[model samples]
Target chain A: MEFGPHLLLATLEGLVQASVLTLTALGLSLVFGVMRVVNVAHGEFYMLGAVLAWFVTSMIGGSAAIGFMAALIIAPLLVGLLAALADWLVLRRIDYDPERTIVATIGLLYIIQQVTLMTYGPDAHPVAPPFNTRLALPWFEFTDGGLSMYWPWGLSTTSYKLFVIAAAIVTLLALWMLMAKSKLGLILRATQLDGETAQAFGIPVEKVYALVFGMGAALAALGAVLVVPIQQAHYLMGDDPLLLSFIVVIIGGLGSLRGTVVAAILIGMSDGIISVFFTPTLAKILATLLVAMVLVYRPNGLFGAKPA
Target chain B: MKSKTLLSAAPTRRNVLTGLAAAGAATALPNFARYAHAGSDAPIKIGFQVHRTGIGAAYGRWYERTTNAAAKVINDAGGINGRPIGIVAEDDGTDPKRGAEVLEKFANQHGCDIAYGTLFSHVVIGSAPRAAELKLPYFVVSEGHHVASGMLNRYTLQPGITDVKSQVQAMAPFVADNLGKKVTMIYPDFAFGHNHRDFFSEAIAAQGGEVIAKLAIPPTETSFTKYFPQIPRETEVIYHVMVGPSVLTFVKELGEFFGPSHPEIFGFIDSLEAVDFASPGLEFLEGTHFWEGMPRYAQSNQTDADKFYRAAIGIDDKGASLDDPKDVSTYAHMFGCWETLYTIKDGMEASGYKGPADRQSLIEAVEAITDMPEGREHPQGAKLFNGKTHQVFGPQYISKVEGGKLVVQHTTSIEDGLYPDEVDYTAQSF
Candidate 1:
């Protein structure tokens, strides 16, 4: 098929985009599951991580590698703590109305975006890519003009994409372990299942809830820190992922970890596929509609019900 | 000093108010002309529709500051063809609907002579129709090409850079020659980003290159994984049109994968800041290139303006140089107010109209200004208006962000000024 390279590359693109999508959306799910509240300001958390990476590594006189690494460790942790404080200071007082909580998070989104704009200005940031090395897939050689691909391989993509794929896997695994194996993980799951019951069983549900919320926010920051080399930091950069993550979580079933992951992959792949075959705007419309249909069919989401 | 004062004399419109009726175009719509000045029995109220928030706030706030300063200067001089000027300032908060309400009050009830200032393109789009309906001359600082490219506008004039066409024309060819191997385009799926995409693709293609892919992610999208698959290893350049944290996130993720060895990548420095590249582990940008609307302020001109503005208004001159040879778009925004106000004085003097709040005299004189005078104090030399188009034509420059500062590398000849037209005048309902 003449379109073989396009199809193969499209599939590859889907997997790559899926990696970041899953990591970012997974963070949302864990927080929502544990706290029973959606932190809509999650995108802002991502924005902060990018800004931190940009400033720490590029602005100060230091090794970019070391500085960026330092930012990765510290920025996300700070974001987590800030998220915890927000939960304590603002949302904690009014979790009764989920609608109000949504409004509150929207306000938080505005606050963070404006603060970032005031501090950073409204410009696109170009973070230095990791190694800038290029490894052709040995199948397709791209000339200054057009493209040609060899047998079976049929297409060439960047080797760094593999890094993204690997990172996503590692993050998902680590998160899975934290959820399934650790003490906090167990407490979080118990709280997710039944907060009052978990509190009765002496799990300290409230403390676990706050910690869980903070950790999810940390994941967002982690995603931000990791991706700064790929895209760049900007103030309004969080709205897209915020919207897509909503679609992903709704399709996967809110509060369902495995479902979020699976749904993220599906959403990512669908996006890539749509961009490949149709136009970007059409693809978005389709993906959004797909989420709507899924919601109509399964209000609890595809995998959202509590496991019996 | 007396001779210097004579040499420094500019065109002045002294006490020339209440004379548009002599021209008798007031007779064309005398009744509405009466409505235009319905409550002007008192001092004329001038309102500012400005962005105190969003990306445009930085310049918008500055524009309002300078406008107020200039208006004050005029009042002290003699008060406009000769009524006193009164200003009513409202914050649009950088939102379009809010901008519309602010304009509605200025036009419908407050009876302003002219409503000026807007930062964001979308917000300008949002407020333009309402301003047009009220027949208020809306001077916006937005650079959206749609504003001047035959849209719904009779009253909205954009004196700044045309962000899309000008940036693309200046930079895309250089990018095609320097880093045209494999280019990827990624931007927010908003109007601003979309404009970049359309122009970048056109410019790149005109240079005999093809855009392998154009990625339009939703607003506030931070993840790069899903988008990375489309970025083939063969990509030699990336055209990033994102803002805020996404810039950092995108660059960081790109770095984690490709590091400094990914081909040459460029971004719109105007849409961002010098700090983003210099401070944020953007070593890849060490020899990086960028397109900006402001050139490095020269010491001589900056010192001159500083001395003059400070001597006149007693405010610190925390502004760019009048002689900075940057692109004209932003220069127009930054310095256009000073020029327009000064130009109005000249026009009123030439046409024998007056101000302070001489609304009729100022509008008639401004509408009649065809050629600018000699040795006038304008940032980009002088500004001439196309009376037919009601837009100003000025110069644009090419720039590169070097050593964390913007330096002008080249410039384009003066082109026509643009105003939003009639088809797309709806700046509301956003």
Candidate 2:
């Protein structure tokens, strides 16, 4: 493969990765933004969503399309409800204390993982995509005669991958609307700004916190459901996504949605592009190094507000 | 004898208490009385160090099932030296540090006669030193080069499975002659992968083939399409071997990247060990070849030994669990657990193993084992055990995917997998 086609393929792969990362990081950012509680169990919620997608699809087996459509709706909703239950049972008792909640969520992480292991077993089971077709991408080249376009070997993406990217965009937009243009959003924002003041103003602060936490986990679950067709559902699958999402959230600016999306694109793209020029292991090292540099220079992150 | 007679005749309070204690022990363990007539009533405890909770859990599940089945077979026919085989299993969590701790627990805490059934190479490498330190004979089913390469201590033996160095080298002749010679290798970036890279490269070079490119994917990578571009255009074959939860994704993405046209692909079945062939994107793998330790799908020429082994493990002809068709067993690798358990039985019987005091003799007995004929005991095939290097040599199978089933294409001779010994483990002190 020529350099042009290679770069093009890498960029496309990066975009697909960035799309999933954006949704996952957005969820992490949302939780920290509103509840002021770092949910270490967020990734397990994502894993649960994928596992549930497999369960739902297998049970409702008619066609891949029908089962997948059903899973898209059911898995996230169930995950959201579970997250709300966890918040009510555990997070509420901790009074959303930052350090204690982190520990609590970590405990929640192990509990969810072990329970899933017992129920789902240890195999990595794949859920078929609703639809998948290989689309061979054409690469442009300048010849002596004129500019030409030809399908380069091994330069292609699947129909399902494109769907994942589009679905992530639509979901992120809806999340934006929910946060920016709704009365519930306004209530949530008020609670986020000052819990005691919002409670005094009859905002139902605890209910808002629980709702925010659920939505955050639901967003992650949504991302997981979309990606499950591409990546199999395994209990340990959550570890990589959790680490990557954390890195994206930190680099994007702790609580900023726009920053999270931008940082996801940056990180995901850099990972893909660097692999083209270097070994995959070196690329990972470089990506982590970039995160370190960013942390050192910008303690508040790119879009994080200075501590009050 | 005189003391025993005196104690029984006197029938004092202490004697009565001792008799009651013996009765309680016999009642609590019913098999105690059955085995007492033969010899020592206590069962031979073999500690199972399993990867029950981490990345290796998928393999661990099948390994446990196979181990249990092998133990039942051994005990039903009268166990090692007439004592029933007792498995004391502990989860290693697939982490090296946890693996070492598990070995300690097996030795001191559980009082196991020997530790066995570690799969991951890193875990075996980490825990084997501790096995040596505790003088516990560690029999690993892990097909890593760590044992044969002389990296591990004398106590650590791989008597069940052939190491990666031998397996990789054995496939070279078929690959160079049948699959094209200009190979591009893609493997995980780790010691296991490095072993494949180095050994295969040398073996292929000996066959007048060259490795065009070597692409090492990071262990944590979930998606792999971007790396496909790095495969040289002139490459005639792509040799890939990957392990982990994301392997399905890796294979699927490779299929999607190449579309209808690609190089002849050869891979280790480790990439799809517990995965089903009927997976969505795996349709593209219909014609590719894989090097299987043991054929996953039962062949038309399948041996009676294989049929018996599969039946014992409760796996169907397709290698899935009998209870659930979707739950595929790690057929290619899990045979090691079955064979290793039997090897332990053979060693104990030969050494006349009585307790932990006989651990050294048991190790010596196993080191003397060489020819293992295909039978109810050694089911995979006839194997030639290297008593010196502490690894086994067996025929390797190459299978091609035809109609979503792996059909055996070629079987290399046991001599094809034999390599010069790197270490004489028997020469080292126990």
Candidate 3:
């Protein structure tokens, strides 16, 4: 069937949604990139961010507008601190075994999710969208490539979606600048490139590693804050996105930030479209097959560098 | 030990200080939180293998609240057979494996007179054999029929009628009487939806109608816009066989169609409960009909039994009498657990002197019951056991969505349907 306006709308939604995915995947890729810790529990961090965002917003935001911004800003930072704490308490003394670490994180994931559930209770907390209306697809063209016909005869984009896309772009750009342009960025790269060498240079590589993990935690929270408007904050909501991020990281080549971004948009679009056609179960089957094919055929993803 | 003696909670401080002001309740009353052994001085412990956490948590939270409240009301009236109902609640978390675990714990560890309640059909089905195995009287408030009927070891009994045939019974008669049309079925491709498709077609055909078209969609298909045209325009009714967010999405898309010049749509009333049919503006569902065997508490069900329902539920401090059937249905469904405890008490009374209320004897008493002690006294009401499959069947009611609420206005008379025994519900087109 030919892709209709709904399809276009779905794709636009997917892209903005992909921004959140890429943001989280970037953090996941960073963790895997440096420590070689599989971080199977990366999604739990995202869930923690969402849960924190939900509770804090419930306390802070008297209204939807205030809640939206407060959650977006504070959720990630708060989660970052929490992530650092988790590292201190658990991961700091964890076994160096990769599979064991993965298994431990998985355990941590369930424990964290269950604890959140026990606290917040299991009902889905609704986070209202910042924008009031859909900017129709047949209106003015957006710089972000979404045609807002839900708008009047002319409007660049639906303000809400445009804000999300802008946020995503700003997040990616800020991450790039932080990694490439800042002193912390330099330390991170140095540690990632050669941990023992960086330590020999008296760089305090342990501090760098901890900080990098915290930043990863912040990104996961940021992703949750952005996602609240679309899906509403739920405990299990992070699982799907978490699995997708794993796919993106693996597809982009583990530890590759740019690779994750490219892979996210493609994966998001495929998932969004296929899910519209089939049930989520079927879409998952297709996604699994796609990931398997990529692993077999490409070995590394399209933009991924060959493994050592 | 997540609160040992989980059958019921430690009574709230409010209930403890201010004893229930019993209003014309009989000697055989229910003992809620206070005075567990008031009835026979021998504690009648009823076990509840319920969902406290997990996916079913949404329903489970309300279920526990209402059931516990009902037990409180029953206690206020009088303890069952002069024995206060001691409840041991266990959290199954809506998992079948977990349900079995809790059922085992409930029967063996807690030594319950009967296992009272479960929400999910899968949980009910999984726990039925165990109920028969340990011979614990398992009372269910689910839509599935397989939990009862089929070669029952006289332990499990559903208070509600079968879902598939009952769903068809509610709609097909309405279709034949009102519209004189057979509907095109667009169901989710699953055992649940397929059961509806197979039965509804036969039900519709039995009424001088032929099935026009049938299309199966994915189980969780949210978008149904493109697939709208897949059902030929020739069909009169577009019966949606889906639930949850999928139903909401499907209806929203169907609202966009504005075709068949008032296309008749049909489905289960359970779908109505999950959805906010009022907003997202389902004026599209206006004048639409669906099957609802369980009537609203106060509006339709105004019998002596309903007094307990009204008192137990509808406690809005805003001073509005709770008429919302959704809330009351949740209350009543859980109330079945309350009544089920009393039924076990009746069985114990019939079985003569009980030591600790053995599981095998309790199940035997439940199976041997000609009618549930608390079952409908009306000729055309829900029958607890019909001696055929040791299951329950009730009159089905048709609900119409009017002015943002699904109110059960009309009800179907009695029908002879020995589902679990005469028909293998599982073997049907799933």
lDDT of 1 at B130: 92
Q: DockQ for each candidate? A: 0.13, 0.60, 0.15
Indicate the TM-score of model 3: 0.78
lDDT of each: 0.64, 0.88, 0.64
Interface RMSD values for the candidates, listed in order?
7.2, 1.4, 8.0
Candidate 3 residue lDDT tens string, B1-430: 3443323367655554444434334443544434434444656677877777655555576567656765676567666666556667889877788898888887677666777678666677777778767766677765554554363345676543444655575457677767557677877675456667788888888788767878787643434544554455567776775542235446654664443254677756544443445433257788787765454423544566555454565533211236652232333234445454455556666676354445555455555666543343221245555544545655666767776556665666546333435533223221
Better of 1 and 2 by TM-score: 2
**lDDT digits (tens) for residues B1-430 of candidate 2:** 4365534666777778888999898787534234433547678888999988777888999899999999998889988887788888899988999999999988887778899999988888889999999999999999999998888888999988988889988999999999999999999887788889999999999999999999998666777887888899999999999988788889988888888987899999988988889867788899999999999999998889999999988999999999998888889999999989888888888999999899999989999999999988888899999888999999889999999999999998899998888888888887
What tier of docking accuracy does candidate 3 attain? Answer: incorrect
lDDT of 3: 0.64
Tell me, by DockQ, which candidate is best. 2
Residues A124-241 of candidate 3 have per-residue lDDT tens digits of 5545555644344453445676764343211112456667778989989998998889988888888888888999999986666667777887898888787665545667666776
Per-model TM against the reference: 0.69, 0.93, 0.78
Off by over 4 Å in 3: A1-17, A60-62, A95-100, A132-170, A200-202, A297-301, B1-40, B148-153, B160-162, B175-194, B205-267, B272-307, B317-335, B353-384, B400-403, B416-430
DockQ of structure 2: 0.60
Name the runs in model 1 displaced over 4 angstroms. A1-13, A51-61, A89-137, A140-165, A306-308, B1-46, B55-95, B105-112, B119-122, B142-154, B157-333, B345-360, B373-376, B396-430
Say what the interface RMSD of candidate 2 is.
1.4
Give the per-residue lDDT digits (tens) of candidate 1, residues A161-271.
667788789989988898789987787888888888998998876567668778888888887777666676767767777888888998999989999999999988888
